[model samples]
Target: MAFSPEKSNFRSPLKGPPSPSWNDLLLKNKKALNHVLFTMHLQSRSNKQTPSSSPSPQIRKSLDFTLPSLVSDPISLLSDQILLSILSKLPDSQRNCNSLVSKRWLNLQGRLVRSIKLLDWDFLVSGRLFVRFPNLIHVDLVNGSLISLGECGCF
Candidate 1:
């Protein structure tokens, strides 16, 4: 009886118990393990991607690892409130610049801005304050040159 692997390279005419070759079993196990690992990777990725907002930069980096058309599910990314909080933490100049990154960002900017100060009102885009920060809870008007009972239209 040849029990060593090196001696079982050839088929024998005598057959007793059918023993599956080690190579064949290993190949099957390898494929199954690969599939299970891939499934685990996907599950873990989804769990980690649902963070408050750090994934913004991470996702951009992830896109470099995948094809442009193979993006992950957008809905599972993050909650709107968390994302808004993250945006609120950014500097005014940065947040305003990034507001044009996507439609989502544009909408988020409006809801995230809790307050703002207007100095030279005329220097701003007309109606831009109201349009961009419609949900702003508090706003300070500092244009000292124009202040009247009926002329505070910009405010």
Candidate 2:
């Protein structure tokens, strides 16, 4: 076979016009690409708005019964001791807010409070202090000024 450049399958490097750049190709198809993307977005939104298929009545009933038990407060499942330990780790500033969460949490937070400054002697006399903070190891009474004289000037 004769070697001929004109009939050869391969073309010379400089023979043809240069290939289009990515930017040019993308710009030319920009409107088409946008339409495709907009349709895809609408499809995704529709998919989210509606379920693909409805469950059977039996399956729905089963889910309805099981869902409540599954969704029950997970925090309530923790034991008092575990909750106390978790509460104890919180900083003093946060303890007050934690107590406000519930009566149980208030009691747990009180147990975690090891020390208290007594501002009112009536609290002690009424036994309300001990009731609120059962585990208090340190009680400050100096600030309460429990030694003030009565109207009769008696101790």
Candidate 3:
């Protein structure tokens, strides 16, 4: 399989099976063998994407570098299913931002809202959060100050 420049030099950070040693013999020219194995890995990954799973060229082009960096926050970098697991534990402010980040996040937020308490004595949302989550059942106002509850149907 043809290798792209990005794939030609990839190296697994692991030292174990599923990555057999036969793929890179110690006696061989170590660097060249490593490059060959890396190429194969990339080829396999590319081939694994079925037509339905592959992004269109437009989508591939529209994705910017920041998208990956934003997602690479280690906790969030976990799989989407895993990210969904901890959404409620995140600060309310973060949940709002994550909700805006992508469709995946928005979908997660929809599921997560059912389980979220939405109000913390220490972190209250007087604006959009309150407006957006109208079903918020209870909020902690202890040791908190009042601010106008903007367009969220709050008093």
- Who wins the TM-score comparison? 2
User: How would you encode candidate 2's per-residue C-alpha lDDT over 1-155 as one tens digit per residue?
Assistant: 78998777886678896678645754587567455444544454456664656556786557544543453454554569978877776678887887998999999988888899998888889999999999999999987755656734887
Model 3, span 5-108: residue lDDT tens: 87575656684445435325432585554444445444554688886887677765554322433333323334557667667767788788879877767867
lDDT per residue for candidate 1 within 1-155, as digits (tens), equals 55797766666678766777534654567556444444545565667775664446777566444532443443224557866877787789988997887888888988777787777566355777777777878777766345666776664
What order do candidates take by lDDT, descending? Answer: 2, 1, 3
Give Cα-based local distance difference scores for all models: 0.65, 0.72, 0.56
Worst 10 residues of 2 by lDDT: 65-74
Off by over 4 Å in 3: 1-77, 115-155
Candidate 2 stretches with Cα past 4 Å from truth are 1-70, 146-155
Superposed Cα deviation of residue 70, candidate 2 (Å): 5.0
Q: For candidate 2, report its TM-score.
A: 0.50
TM-score of each: 0.35, 0.50, 0.28
Q: Which ten residues in a row are the worst by lDDT in model 3? A: 65-74
Model 3 vs truth, CA RMSD: 17.4
Clashing pairs in 1: none
Candidate 1 — worst ten consecutive residues by lDDT sum? Answer: 67-76
**Which wins on lDDT, candidate 1 or candidate 3?**
1
Q: Number of clashes in every candidate structure? A: 0, 0, 1
